[model samples]
Target: MNGQKLLIVEDDLGLQRQLRWAYDGYDVVGAHDRASAIDAVRAEEPAVVTLDLGLPPDPDGTSEGFATLAQILQLKPDTKVIVASGHGARESALNAIGAGAWDFYAKPIDIDALGLIVSRAFHVHALEAENRRLATPATTAFAGLITAAPEMLKVTRMIERVAAADVSVMLLGASGTGKEVLARGLHEASGRKGAFVAINCAAIPETLLESELFGHEKGAFTGAVKTIEGKIEQADGGTLFLDEIGDVPLSLQVKLLRFLQERVIERIGGRRAIAIDTRIVCATHRDIDAMVAAQSFREDLYYRLAEIVVRIPGLAERPGDAALLARHFLHRHAKAMGRPVTGLSADALAVIDGWGWAGNVRELENRMKRAVIMADGKLVTAADLDLESGGAPEPINLKAVREIADRKAIRHALARAEGNISNTAKLLGISRPTLYDLLKSYDLHA
Candidate 1:
């Protein structure tokens, strides 16, 4: 035995004993009914399960066995379920395959044949697990970026390619979309020796912004008691991040254009042109082209600042990453808050997926921090995050009503099971096969 667990959900005492002894290659456990089977699934998370559809109350009926199958899959979608069918239950065996069963076998159990099926399922499980492990980025790869979705690799590639360059770069994205973080990543990638200074053009007052960017000499103004270096001089040997560059006033734009062109600055009261060496990386949510067309922003300065432009996708565009990030945030916050919180409830995860996330990564991070603090149960629920599970109510059509109800019920079971497919099926009082069919019909993932 390789220590791989195999759960056998069979009601027959003789057959159960036969299976436990016959499967010498597996550490086997037996469950006599729906309740025990689901409990075993939640506990053991067995790589494979052999289920017989007939139970005590419905010894001749397929209902109970089928129910066990669904709940098991609901609890663990990756578990390979092997359903047993008698000669008369061949149709049910076929239904098992459609419901996501790994394979099916008829009664008068052929030990060698069943062994082959079990071995294949375990092998597949190992391969898939390995693939997922390999898909995650190594901690040192992106420095600060956290993503498991394959699509984010494209953005990573772009950042890597541009990191070593000295050219001016512009980042375009909605607010709170990690533009500044990426700007820092770009600076780190460049291997620059100086500090990275950042200022939000939109946040500073229009009158004081000029002096903020360029230093003032003594007697230059009422507060100029001593000479002060502005943001430009302060970033002499490093990078200067201009956030919300679109809102920079036109007069200040001319002065900034001079620095980019001359590589030097002059204090407000001093005539000496002081030399500075700094790389410029700016970010904004506005359309600079539109501003240029309307003459609100100078076209010459736009070209100078935008030597390279990177467009960042909103949180919704990176599929699979929302769940990955939500988990990341939950763990991080739970540890910081010293909470016993574990993971997101299935409905909570579903809510994370369903929400538009207009605030992107920042919004997700904030919600997770709050969820960790508010979580009363072991896992974070949609209520903790204040997220709803689905769209608005549907019309009175029977088909639509059934779909809406089915989706909601499936979501509820998944939430209660904490995404345990087997447990979900058990809760629904249906077989794993039936649950799989329903999930497929509703276009939902287990």
Candidate 2:
């Protein structure tokens, strides 16, 4: 295990010395009061913290201690906070847990037991942090495509397979679903010698669109003094990605179809047919079949371009993928910005899983980037991602209410058995069949 930094937030100097000595394995930092504790948290940014509820200015009450806890969480939400209260152990522990503390301990501090709890908290914190890192979207092969859904996986596999071939490839997906990244990946995989050129058919005007694709000869027209090579010629021996190909004008479509069929291009105002070697990849979020039906797009050109078609799945279709992508983006942006972001909280992960990401992977990436930059604490919370905190705690219907109870029971049993359902049921004084039923009801596997 990696040696982690630990902060002890006790006002008693003697107890601080004892705790620090006991946790010799940890890089222990001590803070006797609220000001010092907050300072320690900011400066050290420790992964796990031990907080004493009896603090200065309100040493007998939990007011100051709870305030410190709230501040620490607000600043660095990822830190594992373990609260210690001498006066009212049960109340303090429960209150702390409700307020988002990781775990709590009663005091006349059992040094060994507290040490074990602290160690366990640290282990859990580290594991969660690692999970978040692994789940982060930026770590995946594709830059912004976030999905673990089998349908999306099939599309990715298709892209991978077709990328090795020299055939014309087309991508179909909804807007903001990251077709361009897939296009770029195809270019990278093709082993092309020249640059991967890109042009958006819908973004550029029709007047300049022709000039954008096919080069103009010197004095080809007014303001064409110098010879200029279009995107196709520039991408010779490489890939030319045409985005929003459905919007290409009829005139340009004929020219493009001719080039695809003959492998030759006639630059504007030039007589010679220039033999060019360039791969073509096109993408459109629109339904090409409908466009072809409407006679807005050339059917012949569509058939020629879409020799291999890949369809990308939207974000909501992928189960567990949004959380994975969120974590990935957080790690990347945090590292790039030099922030001490540990990972997303459990609630945050749940929110990510539940959200309907209509804007797809692009939206998820943007949210994570912003959350990582703005996060004051080590862990990103649901609130940081603009998700509801604790995520609809109360179930409205009987079915949902039962499901919630079942989920809670299964989670508790799993925890008690250290994630072994068989052992957990035995501990819960329940049969394996009953446990399995509970698991199924809650949509929980383990």
Candidate 3:
């Protein structure tokens, strides 16, 4: 706390001195207006800021103060800004929070209560900063998988385990979920001598997909001028990644099954059978189970190909990952595009975390690339990303929304209470049992 800098954005000199001296442990800094506030933020990099929503040229209103708050947060997202409002404190507080202020206080400041809020804000800010720093774990060479989300971590562990075994593996997830990336990771991990071969069963028509997967001899067809080896034989002793395997034509499924079972392929119009020892890794966004039920896919082939199945959670399921991945993408693209942009604004990070990311990693990659190229400021804003800051509304399920709200409230109280359960319960105006139930329901550690 000694080194934790505090920025006071009060235009009034008496109040500024009073507030600065009141917080003895903090390294206090001052900014009298919107411009200075943003300057102090860039220069001092304060961890917390107490801002009065009344500053000149608009001291009679909060417009200037609101602008200052936005700019300060844009420079440093993790800096917790506590807003002070004399007029309509309650409504202003809510609006400030919506605008990304950490907390709000009323005028005629009770120094002690405001101090408590400041302390709580700093403590939570530290916790979150540490969480972000430690989120990424040391994993194997998965170059494309950029995540620290627990669900993705589990998938990574599964990939590592299955890749070591040299058996048929199936990956299931929504489109743009980085299936090909994981397939490449599997190939890198498999320690095979041959090349990593890939073929999208869905992209190619059924008439040509079979020949693509299983080779054809010379004069096998009108276009077959020379004896060509297919993806399977090309892989030889490496890995064969079959993307969108669910789209493999039923007529070709039998041949794939034979290759998996017999470890040999019969080239079209060829008498001799060639053997290969390629590890098969297949992925599909389609529900192969439903296809098997409809007889669109062969059940026997599905079983043969799916010696091990790994389900990759969609981007929505991997909470707390979007911002982390966004940071990575921003850094990578900024360097590649020769941009001076180094970070994202608070509003940009807020929108990224709250967005649904329907197209998953692919969409994120595109947005970040565009943002890096278009960004004019040192930090990327929501405008740069071409994204709406207003997030999608929550589902109309009262129970779900209530639980979400309760969990958030409980977590806030816990942060204020400094991890003391009894204090948290008291702060939340709830019994210990109720608090315990919430913690359990939300799978919170404490």
How good is model 2 by TM-score?
0.56
> Which 10-residue span in candidate 1 carries the lowest summed lDDT?
390-399
The deviation in Å at residue 357 for candidate 2 is 1.2
Residue-wise C-alpha lDDT for candidate 2, range 1-446, written one tens digit per residue: 24699999999899999999999899999999999998888777788999998899888888888999998897778889999967556787789989989998887889889989998988898788766544433123543555544456667767878887989999998876778888988888778888899999999999999988998899999999988899999999999999999999998999999999999998888898998999999999899999999999999999999999888778765555676677678889999999999788766766776678878888888989988977889999888899653223333345656665555545444533434678878856789999888765444545
lDDT for residue 333 in candidate 3, whole number 0-100? 93
- In order, candidate lDDTs are 0.83, 0.81, 0.82
Instruction: Count backbone overlaps in model 3.
Output: 0
Model 1 ranges off by over 4 Å:
1-141, 390-446
Error of 3 at 92 (Å): 65
Colliding residue pairs in candidate 3: none
Comparing candidate 2 with candidate 3, which one achieves the higher TM-score?
3
Among the numbered candidates, top TM-score falls to: 3
What TM-score would each prediction reach against the true structure?
0.58, 0.56, 0.59
Model 2 per-residue lDDT at 167: 98
